[model samples]
Target: MGRQLATALLRASSLEPRHINISTRRPETLGGLFLDQRWVSAVLYSLLNMCTAQKLGAGKTLRLLNGLFETNTFTYHSLVNSPSASDLNSPDDLFPWMSLVDAQTKDTPLTDLVLRDKGLRDCFSVMYYNVFSNLAEG
Candidate 1:
């Protein structure tokens, strides 16, 4: 499932597999797991950036995210079905359809949206920080 999501994101974005630092695991490494959070963060960031770069509408963005989630074995619900919220107070509250609709309706660029929306700015900041920190640790 992870591989599928990664592949799809890579195909959609300008990122290359080497950018994620993916490598073959050896038998000796089997006992220990190396779940690189940086890889996940990087892929997600790239995916979001691609969406913004393409100026995808809310419907298309939602579908892309839903498709990625559905790649896993678990039953995934559509993001559109999630209850709407007036404000996004935190990262957990991010992705309310209202925000996407606003962005789409206004045709706002990602940089402008990030600057104008505190919740979105904070979310991106957190993800960027995590990616850099994980890279340093790794």
Candidate 2:
């Protein structure tokens, strides 16, 4: 689960690598979180470490995300395994946002600050992955 969070965080392309901070000491380390790709982040809440998840609250979590996204509304949908074009074209109040596009479509894409991360991991996760990957590749 910790690795999953790290993976999710590293996926945020818009975020400067220095902004993220994560633990380097662990079973998996931060290399498991791969960035430098166009793939979307897909983090399963169930996969998160129990202790880490326990420290989070739904409202608090939302607030934290909003802070990152820098918007009251931070929505992210995975591009790799996204819904069908028909489903996306369907009329709905809830718009699934994408991270790369910025057009005025019926549905708004999740290309903003916080929602940019497909997996939506915290800053710590992204930072750790950045540092770890650099060390590993170097």
The Cα local distance difference test for each model comes to: 0.42, 0.38
Writing each residue's lDDT as its tens digit, candidate 2 over 18-86 gives: 664445465265345543222222222221122134454334544444564344553223221245323
After superposition, which runs of candidate 1 have C-alpha atoms over 4 Å from their true positions?
A: 1-29, 36-39, 71-138
Number of the predicted model whose lDDT against the real structure is largest: 1
**Ten contiguous residues with the weakest lDDT in model 2:** 42-51
Per-candidate clashes come to: 0, 7
Q: Model 2, stretches more than 4 Å misplaced?
A: 1-39, 44-52, 68-138
